[model samples]
Structures are given as C-alpha cells and as structure tokens.
Target: MYQRFRSFFLLAGLFLLSACTSAGITVANAPVPFFEGTIERDIVFDEESKQTLDIYIPDRATEERLPVVIFFYGGRWTNGEKGDFAFVGTTLAEQGFVVVIPDYRKYPDVRFPAFVEDGANAVGWVHKNIGDYRGKSETLFLSGHSSGAHIASLLIVDERYLEDGTISAIKGFAGLAGPYSFTPEAEDVKIIFGPPSQYPQMQATTFVDGSEPPILLLYGRDDEIVAPYNLERLRRKIEEKGGQVQAKYYSDVGHIEIIGAMSWIWRYKAPVVDDLALFFRENSDN
Candidate 1:
C-alpha cells in the first residue's frame, strides 16, 4: 500500500511540473473516478471561439436547486482551456454544486479587458441559463486560481466588468493564489494589461469600496510566483473599505499546489476543495 501511494505521488509530482498544460492535468486526473457527476461541454457563452464553457452537474438526488460556481483556470493570461480543468469541475460538482468552467481569449491574441470581458459574458450566460441545469442563479459564486483569480476578483470588485444586476446576484467569490494587487513588471504582462496609466484598472484592489460581495482569499505561504503580499493588499483594502472578506493561508503549498490540490489525487496535500465548498455553502441562501 505504501509503495502504491509512493508511486502516485511520484507521478503527481512529475505532472505538477507542467500543471499549466492540459496534458499534465488530464493525466493527473486520469486515476480519479467520475461517477459522482455529469458534464456538459462546449456550451457557448459568447460569440467568440474561446467564449465557451463546461458545466458539471452532480448525480446525487436532490430536489433543491444546487448553488452554482463559475471557476476560471489560470495560465498567466496566456494559456488555459475549460477542458484542461475537468478535475476542478468534477470535484466541485461532486460536492453538489453546479460548476461552470469557461475559456477566455488569452494575451498576444487578445489583452486585458478583452479576457476580463469574456469572463463577464460567461457569467451573464450562466445567470441566464444555469437554471436549466438545476443551478440557483441567486446562489452563484465566482472562483479561480492565479490569473484566473485576478479575473474573478476584478469582476466582483470592479462594477464596470459585469452588469449591475449580475454583480449584485453573486453571493461570494473565492480566489486562490490571486495576483490581486500586482503591478505588471514583465514585458509580456505589461503588454497584456496595457500601459502604466491603466494598471490600476487591472487591479482588483483599486476598486474596493465596501459594496462588493463577500470575498474569500486563499493563498499559499510558500508561493513564489505571485507574492503573498498581493493577497494581503487586497484583504487590507477590503477591510479598510468595510467590505466582508476572509483569508486562508496554507503553509506548505506553493502556487501550483494551491490549485493542484483540488484534484483528488493530490487532495491529501490540502483541503482546498472542501474549503471552497464550505465557503460557498456558508454564503449561499440555499
């Protein structure tokens, strides 16, 4: 038994090195059972080619409408797809939540507001059509990892990204390893967000005004990619503005492990999935 567990961890570690890629994530989740849910793939959320999403619905018997969570995958704003995150949808759906994973246009091909706008459009689609999937729109939540978290956070805090009604409909937001307050320093990142003049607009912290929905910020103390200060900055800003916010930090988890732990194969590393599900349930009316 110990040998089997060791082999699993070794394989998981190898995949974690390339966790940003679809193949890596797919292989890592290959061993996990999917009998807990059903998936609806390639649902169109907008007119663009990349503006599609996947929905995961629990198979458990329940008359109550399930709360919905729209999750975005991170790839430094350059690469990621809904299909790459089937593990996320499956695990979250297994928790009895309807999960929506959307694909947005990436940098070089597109930039800043374009990707963020795609996220908004995806939410709009979910707001209008998630009822068909047994999801309660009023219990809707937004969540993501890394750059995806940045996108979700911006949507919640910056009213300009989503419609007033849609923004108001959100019950809460959960961000993992988000770059909420980072200034673009790399050339590609700077170009992705546009000029220095628009940097503030790209930050979720810049728009905190005490009126946003409740937020849960989860981060890794050892994350080297995006500094922990990003989470601290956003948390402090929200507190200063009197907005509801909570934070959780995992001591041993890093940038990739923070999200990777969502997969059942690596779940023992952290209780990320349970934490997120609990946070959503705590905030949901249902």
Candidate 2:
C-alpha cells in the first residue's frame, strides 16, 4: 500500500510536469505589467550560443546597488530554457534583486561536469560584470529548482568548480526542491552523472565541510520525483560540519508545485518567492 501510494503521486507528478511545461511557457511569456521589471535579454556568458543569460532589473531604478541572484531552471539536466523562467527573474527583480537566468548545454550534447562547468563560468562572468547592471557583486546569491538546484548547490559546495576567490563571492544559496544527495540508479541520470566512481564528485553533500555559504533548502512533503531524503541528508551533513543551513518542508506541495508557486498565477499555492526573498535579505551582507 505504501509503495502503491507513492507510485500514484509519482504518476500524478509526471502528468502535472508535462502539462505545466506547456502552460508555464505561455504564462511566463505573457505580459505582466504590474511587475514592471526591465530585462536585458540574451547576454552571452560563453562562446557557445546556448551559454547565454537574461537579466531582470526592478523598474524603479537608482544608483544604489541591488543584491544579485543567479537562478538556474530545472529540466533533469536534459531540457529547459531560460525563457521558461522569465517569471522567476521578473518576480525576484520586482523585489529589488538583479536576477539572471542562464541557459546551459543539456545532456547528450554534454555530460558530467560540462554543464556544471558552464554554471561556474556563468557565475564567474556575473562576478566580473554584474556591476554594469547596477548590482552589488559582494551581495550575490544563488538559487535553482530541481536539477538546477543541484547545479547551483554543487557550485557553492564544490570549490573546484570556480576559482578560490569566485567561491567566496557567493553570499548565500536557496534551493527549491533540489536533489542534493541522490546516488543515481536511473539510466538517464546515470548517463548524465555516472560511472559509479564519479557519483561522489557529483553530490553536493559530499563536499559539505562547514566552509560554504549559508543555504536555504525548501522541499515539498509530497514530492515523489525526488525524495525528501536528499534534502535531509545534505542539511544534516552541512549542520554536522558547522555550516549554516536552513530547511523548510511545505505540506501537500509536490516537486513542480513549489516552483510553480513562484509564478503570479500560482503564488497562492506557496510563498516560494517571498520565502526566498526573505532568506536572501536575511543572509546577504549588503
């Protein structure tokens, strides 16, 4: 009965994800005048065309430097686009953050640390260039949903991805439904992060040793796609190492719902945007 119930939620989550992708793209592209955020789109971070990012800035501008956030969208490390997360950038930007959503090469095209390397380079670019967008380089934060969160967390916890100085530039991190401690048994995941021997290097939890930036981990109690155990394991490790970490589990929320709650149409489902904003504010040095 327990296994059957979990299977039910897993199938339901899959259906919702399929429906959400199409609907989400439409909703994200729709004009949201109330938010009134300005966007600087398609800025190249790497030589490749897919290695581009979009910046969202709050409408009421001043010379004051706003805190910066680099958010990555999730697609199981296989599919997703920066445009699909336009709402995320705008919503956070409206809250006075300079938000960037980047595009990275997905699996098959590249695998195992290639995309992560792209993520690292993207942050490196932001560290050196965010000032041009009136953002405080010192107050930069990181965030992502699902596999995107995995990538974001790896960049924070794994120092080898970025230069020593670049790692310290990150003020904090927030992960919404991230998979941080999973040892992939699934075929596709294995292909993206495989060869068993390399699994440890792929896990953010493996690198937690009390030296990383503060983290806010948000998970859904009903998420069947990625188990809550992933969040628990990482949080425990970070805490044991004396690193600062905060975690919250929302009742009845599922994998996709947490991120969907960030959208204007679904904001009532959860306070994902508000929670992240507050966490960033509380943890930021700026």
Candidate 3:
C-alpha cells in the first residue's frame, strides 16, 4: 500500500508539474506600456505536423516596417514550452520592435535537423509574415539563451540548415551565455556540442565571416554552465575573418543573470539591448 501511494503521488506530481509548465507566466506582472498589444497564434511551418510559432508585436511603433527579432528559448533542446516566455514577448514588444518566439520539437521527439529546421522556418515565417504584424525590417536578428543560443550559432556556422528551410540570410546574431564551441566536457554536454572532432564547423566562431551577420556576444564572468572562452573564441574568429562582431563580458553576472538583466527589472541590460537595436537599425537602413 505504501508503494502504491508513492507511485500515485509521484504521477500526480508529474501531472501538476507539466500543467505548471504549460500555464502562462505571470505575464501581467511586467510593467504595462512596454507591451502595447499582443498576437498569440500558431503557424504550421510544416504541413504534415502542426509545427508552428507564437509571435508578438511591440506596442509603440511609428510605421509598418518595424524591425523584427526572432527569439529562441533554451531548454537543452528538451522540456521547454512557448508559454515559458510570455514575458519576453511583453518586454521586447514594448521596445518598438516585433518579436517572434517559437516552440520547436525537443529531443527524443526529434533531433538536430528537426529542431534546427523549425528555427529556420520560424525566421522565414517572420520574414514572409512580419509585415502583417507591422514588423518591417528587411534585416532579421536572432537571439537565444543557453541551448537555444547553441542552435543559433550552429545555424549561422552551418548555413545549410537555414537554406534548407528558406531563411536565406540572418542579419545579426546574439548569444547570451551560449555554449558555442562547447566540447566533450561535462559528459552530457559534449553530446549536444558534438564530439570534439567536429571542432571548427560546430564552433560558432568558425562561421563568423564577412558574409555572415554581425554578432553581438554577451557573457558573464562567473558563468558556471558555459565557459567564457566560448565567447573569446568567437570574437577572435570573427575579427580574423573581417566580420563585425562585438563581445561584452560582465564582471559579476552569472549565466542566468545575463538573461535576467534583459528584463524590464534591469534596464542596464539596455546597452546590450541597444547594441542589438543599433546593429539592426544600421544594417536595415542601408
């Protein structure tokens, strides 16, 4: 009877946890006015399955051709949902830009190309559809936290993934504490970054070149998850290739802190935010 009760409680706990994961965040807590309005819907990028995106538009915009940013949330390529970032939508949307955040299939359900394909298609979707939301930059920017950053880096380094999905070119890339150039260390982490033998191609730095988009890289000095060397390597590579890339390393911020700093609570991250905005503004205006 004790075992039976234990299993029943365990199952109940799991169900409750999943419910919590899917539920909307305290989105209303974010300061108002930053988020003027919102658009919550799904677009089936793949017809066979319901692969889709949940996009949001910034509140105050002057014109129809507003700049657009596509954000990918990190979950180690598993166990993350769209509802997890309702706050991201609210915050960036308020910034006079349109943001599209998408949910891609996670591990065990589908692997690399599947999730990568979804990301590229999500960008294509925005490019093809952002005008409907008044997001009008011919230039598109990509940003992500942790694993999502990994995928972003990989997409730039290995352009095939985007080409396959029809996203053509990405104007800029931003990674916050992303595990770019991650190696076969930390046992499990190695599998996600690919065995060391794949080095240059898998490293986000390898893809930094004149043809590649400008990159604004941010990292925390105290990050325990992804090392600081990852950013250094990419910075050096991009510089070597004559690609425009700027990197900022924070002294006290940690991995998650860097992401938190971007929120409405920490406007200081605004510099980092502005770096991105300026990069887009400069590139798109031309």
Candidate 4:
C-alpha cells in the first residue's frame, strides 16, 4: 500500500510539473500571465467586489465576430479566483475564441444560490457586452470545471436565473467533472448546499429537460472527488427528456488533470482543448 501510494503521487507530480512552462505557472502562487493578450481586467458584473470578470481577446483580431465562451473556475464554491485560471483564458483565446473568466463570491462569506446568482449575472453581462470585444452575442457558450461546472449547468437547466432572451443566447454548455446529481452527504457539502430539502434546488439534475441548450459532459474515469456516476446520471436525465447531450470520459485522467490537460504540455494526457473547441464550434449558430 505504501509503495502504491508513493507511485501515485510521484506520477501526479510529474504530470503537473510538465505543464509549468506551457502554462507560465510553476506554482499556484506564481504570477499568472495577465498581460498576454488584450485583457480587460476587473470588469464589474455586479455590485459585489467578487462579482468581477476578466476578458481575453483572441490574438488574431478580425472584423468577423468571434464566438464567446464564459468560463467559471472550480474551488468548491468556497475558494477560487478567475486569476487562477488565466491559462484557461489564454489557451482558449489563442484558439481564436473570446474567453471571459469570472470570479464569484464563495462560501463562508455567503452560501447557496448566491454564487449561482452571480454566474447568472455574469452571463447576462456577457450577452449584453461581449460584442464590444469582437464576440458574437448569438454564439455565447458556458463552461467550467467541478463546482464551476455545477454553476454553469444550473444556469442552463434552470431558466429562472437568466432572462428569456439571455437563455436563448446560450448555444451550448460544457462541464468538466461537475457534480450534477450528488445529494450532499458530507458536512461541508451539506453546509454549502443543504438543509436536505434545499438540495433539489442546488442540483442541476432537477432541472434537466429537452428545453436546455446542447450539453457536453466531460469526466475523468478515475476521478474520486466527483465520481463518474454523476456524469452518467445527468446524461441519463437529459436523454430521457430528449435533450441534446454528450458525455466523454478520459481514461488517463483524474479530476484536476482533466482540466489541467488544457495546458500545452499536458495535451498528451487528454485533448480537452481540441475537443472543447470542436464541441463549441459544432454547436454554435455561426
């Protein structure tokens, strides 16, 4: 058991180290590339300080409007910042897609529905303003990893959060290792999405129907933090409603590594970047 544990961490460390240069980040505390492109920083999306976002314009500018992707980073609704996901913005933007990463208020400071509400506000803001950054309002997509995915999923499944027109503006939704069907058994999870009865409101599964935007569910087969069952459950629910949904599992990846593979060096682990680009393009109106 000891030897097996040692090997697991050793392999994980090697994989993580491989992406340092490509991501321009060696450690979590290392400076993220804030000046890589035309970055619009700290744009206010709501009244709270945490409800701010950063926009990354593609390197290749064109008169033709580009598709936009509004992404949220995952940290269990208690921790995370859009700055931590600069690599995600830069990589997707480099592919000629306008990317916006938003920061929402987390737990301890607030609780359930607040963060998701902030996500809804950010989407509304993007729908109203992405055109100024050369993005097509009609080609807007939503994506996130883990908790961020949960928030993004909720925005699509629950129409109440977004105005009718804004909901129509969403072309697709992509989630990475999102917990869409869990019942929140852990104390911390219960606190974040609990009172038991309220768990239904926090679940994306509760709102899945054929009316949702096209959905892509990506998961790491080896993920222990969020089991693959969550993906399967959500997929089943969507399919039952005759919704357009697809699920992909990466055998070589775990939770963090699935999203981590977006970096240049980690592409070999999983072609998440290419797959996502294809999914977004195929689902976009343009």
- Count of backbone clashes for each model? 0, 0, 4, 0
Off by over 4 Å in 2: 1-20, 48-50
> Pairing residues by index, what is the TM-score of model 3?
0.79
Off by over 4 Å in 1: 1-23, 31-33, 48-50
Best by TM-score: 1
Give the best candidate by lDDT. 1
Q: Who is ahead in TM-score, 2 or 4? A: 2
Question: What is the alpha-carbon RMSD of candidate 1 to the true structure?
Answer: 2.1
* Pairs of colliding residues, candidate 4: none
Instruction: Please write out the lDDT profile of model 1 over residues 27-102, one tens digit for every residue.
Output: 6567546446678889888875547899988886656689999999999999878787888888888888999999
TM-score of 2: 0.91
Instruction: State every prediction's TM-score relative to the real structure.
Output: 0.93, 0.91, 0.79, 0.89
| Model 1: lDDT to the true structure | 0.87
Give one digit per residue, the lDDT tens place, for model 2 in 1-286.
Answer: 9999967854554455548677555654455556576789899999854589999988665688889999999999999999888888888988889999999989989898998999998999999999999888878899999999999999999888988777777889999999999999889889889889999999998999898888999998889998989999999999999999999989888887898777655577788988999998887773
Whole-structure CA lDDT of model 2: 0.87
Against the true structure, what is every candidate's RMSD?
2.1, 6.6, 8.5, 5.5
Q: Could you tell me which residue pairs clash in candidate 2? A: none
Lowest lDDT 10-mer window, candidate 4? 22-31
lDDT (10s digit) by residue, model 4, range 30-82: 32454356888999989755479999996564687889999988988988788
lDDT of 3 by residue, 85-148 (tens): 6666666666666777888888767755567777876776777767777777365778888888
| Arranged by TM-score, best first | 1, 2, 4, 3
Clashing pairs in 1: none
Which ten-residue region of model 2 has the weakest summed lDDT? 9-18
